[model samples]
Target: MTTQPHFFIEDSLLYAEEFFAGLGKITRFSGRTVTADDIKDADYLLTRSTTKVNEALLYKCTKLKFVGTATAGYNHIDADYLAERNIEWAPAAGCNADAVADYVISSGLNLANKYGFALKDKKIAIVGVGQIGKRLTKRFAALGCEVVQFDPVRAELESAFTSASFADVLACDFITCHVPYVKSGKHTTHHMFDKQTLLKLKPETILINACRGEVINNADLVEVLTAGHDLRVVLDVFENEPEIEMALLPLLEFGTPHIAGHSLEGKARGTEILYQILCQRLELPVEIKLQDLLPAMAVDHMVLTEKYQLSQRQFRALMNLVYDIRNDDVDFRLGLAKSPDSFDSLRRNYSIRRELTSLKIYCDDTLYPTFTNLGFNTSLIKGE
Candidate 1:
């Protein structure tokens, strides 16, 4: 008889159990409460950001042979240590690109509408041109927005690609960050935004950070905003999360827990990726498909009878039907009102968030591109 793989999985990862059916001995644990003692006997560890898979947690976990995080960022994983132990590691990067792109678009639209600036005419600087940034670039270009992308790593990797100058980035009307959390070196992203850097931003600049909280210095931001600086901000991640700086809340245009990549499809995709990786490692034929695991959406289809207007309000209204970013802000504030410990609670009980692909829109050729670019599933009206 073949030896069965012992697996430890985080329960919050969507569809993980369904994908791993008949594959191994499964043990599910809450990321918040899982301990090294809990996973000591496991042959594999699959987790999300909440579970810190470092030497501290894994030193005693000798039986583990594989480790994977169903998340875009692997900053929580000690890859060097895993490699030293000869344990393989991988992250489901780009799994949440569509979801995050949706968040950025919705947030940008809100800011544009509130600030009286047309999105198509605004200049946007996107820091970190990774999967999420690339999607935002394509979508923003389709919307007629001028986007300046900057990623030093990508610039070095791709000879044809040129990263934008930092000065040019700071000069834009809007600056959004989607970089990973890098703590050391020339390209370090931690505390990239300080009092000086924050002050350097253009007046009325809409600054958005969805990637990581330390990306923007929270305390420095509080200082900047308190000192009468003008920076309209929207932040999804924060420093010292689950215990955020309460003073920073009132200063933000919209503040949320780290849920930018929390779309149902995104989470499922991340899990599916890890499952596929395990399948590959085991040399098993891949039989699972993401589409098969998803449920029928509540608001799955719509038809546009008239010509679609591309105003920020109209664009934002259409997005609102699928997801209202403002509601999250309201819920975030209210959750904090009820209890400071509600940050993770809100995330754990995060409502069903379907991506734009879940909603199919039938529109004429004149309006098809916009909807599709914004991540909607669109079909042209045949007779139109």
Candidate 2:
């Protein structure tokens, strides 16, 4: 009898244990706590961004032939080292694009509402126009915000998008970064927003960083904030990760533990992509569907009973019922304060978050098209 391959997966991957049960024997360890010896006998190793995959971790895994990261970013994995050893590796790129876009929209709209500024009157500068950046541009444009994109890489290929300079991006009312963590090269994103860059921003600018923590220097940011800069900052990713600078919390309009891409659909999509890749490599049938692994939605449908037409504020409130930034912000602040060392634990224990695609909204005709375009399942209610 041919023995089934053994797979070791990170504990944070949603539905991983259940998804891979029939395919092979599985063992799961905390992503950050995983050691080289833990995966020594495994044929496959699946990890998230927390665990670093390099020579040290793979040295003991003699039987390991395949490695996969269920994330769009592959900076944690040493692809060069894997290629040298003839180990096939796969990363789920653009898997969480929609999730991160949703985060930007939710937070942006919330800030606009709080500051009493119309989104249509604001200009948003997107630092990178990759999968997440494209989604953000589309959504913000649909909301009537003037979108400026800054991606030389994509601008060189696509004539439709005229790239803006770094100085031009800083002049916008809102600046959101979606660039990958590029350590070297002319377009390097490491400390892209350093002391000099941060100094260029106007006091009213709202800065958001969800791409990578190291892309923006936290120390410089803290110094700027401490000096009484009036910039509204929102950070989902940090430089040192779980060991985040607690002092920066008070200065931020919103803060979350790198969960902008942790939506249920996104996480499931990442796992499914890797599953398909692994099946092809092992010559096994790809029979799994991402939808099959998802549990029932916590909130399937919602009804809006408004006397008059639905305003943007009302729409935002209804959307918040589905997915609220404040919940994550509050949970992160409380959890982190109580347990400073439990940064990964906070992410691993994040509540079941669904994407906008998972929700159905019943609203007036005025709001039907907008909500539908925003990826919500919407039905026009005849009665106001």
Candidate 3:
């Protein structure tokens, strides 16, 4: 037999090696270029961000029946071309929404507290209300804040939520962006928040970008900051990523290595969802065992109010002690700024982070209950 059906893995499939090892004739090609010739005899093609599937590639891979990308962004793949060729494609969507949202909410709330602002009374504006946006809205709303969202695609579905024009969202105290990349279109967010948009915000507003970097013009942002505009900026993504504008470094209130959604649970879930889709599309038995990351030890988190003497005022300090936003910023500046050659290496090998489950908050005399009420898991650090 001709080695049953061949499955080719291009780009790094974080946990795909183990998932495909049990199947027949699986070849792991990490970061290899996925050309037409490479997929000529292959029954399935697996890839991550690096590979792009289009007409040229499809015409070459006449035998390829399935394309599986273990990423949320499908813009790299030509979906229409694949459909015309009767080829199936699958991508993991919304798997990392909570993880991304957790990062945004935690960072936003933490930043607000740091700046002597009350989150409950603030108005938050969110653009591109997709999966990540919806999660962000919920978390912010949970904290007793009003969330105004803008997304033409979701205006009807999100009608229950406060809707607003883009300009209206810009007028809020805090603005968070979550639109995807669009090369060319009426809704192209290529430079949605350019110099003009940046100038529209109030001087005291907090500007956040967790979506694509190009969504905001880097030069315009730097110019605004240079001109004495003191908007607090938090960035988890940047244009020309891994090569952030050096001038913008000093302007950021919080910066990270784009690991906002790098939470252990979310990464594993993304892998699991991708694997299942691959199996179903290829008509094979899913043999991949999706292992959840090791859960963190629990501590008594109830007595937070009593043991730590924490009130709402101290919430920022508590979160900072546990998750330092500045540390991530420092690491990004140091790691990426050291040399340009190490950019790809640093990003691909970025550190693995724990979820909220990994944290351990301790307390005495029922302090655990109080911490849990405050939305923290504290059983690990506490001695039961």
Each model's TM-score, in the order given?
Answer: 0.92, 0.87, 0.82
Off by over 4 Å in 3: 1-4, 32-37, 55-59, 156-162, 279-323, 340-342, 357-384
lDDT of 3 at 156: 55
lDDT by residue for model 3 over 1-384, one digit each (tens)?
556767887746666666766655677665446667666777888777677778876686767878877777787899998888899888878767766776776677677767777887778998888878877776677566788988865665656655588878888988888888886776788989899989988987888888888998999999998999879899888889766787887788887767777766566666678778867765788765654434543431223434455544566565554455666677777876787445556666777664443455666555555444444555634355
The Cα local distance difference test for each model comes to 0.87, 0.85, 0.72
Pairs of colliding residues, candidate 1:
none
283-346 in candidate 2: lDDT tens per residue? 8888878876767776788776643666668667766866889889999889888988777788
Better-scoring candidate (lDDT), 1 or 3: 1
Worst 10 residues of 2 by lDDT: 303-312
Local lDDT at 40 for model 3: 70
Question: For all candidates, what are the clash counts?
Answer: 0, 0, 19
What does each candidate score in C-alpha RMSD? 2.1, 3.2, 4.4
Model 1 CA lDDT for position 158 = 99
Model 1 residue 3 CA deviation in Å: 3.4
Candidate 3 has its poorest 10 consecutive residues by lDDT at 297-306
Off by over 4 Å in 1: 59-63, 306-310
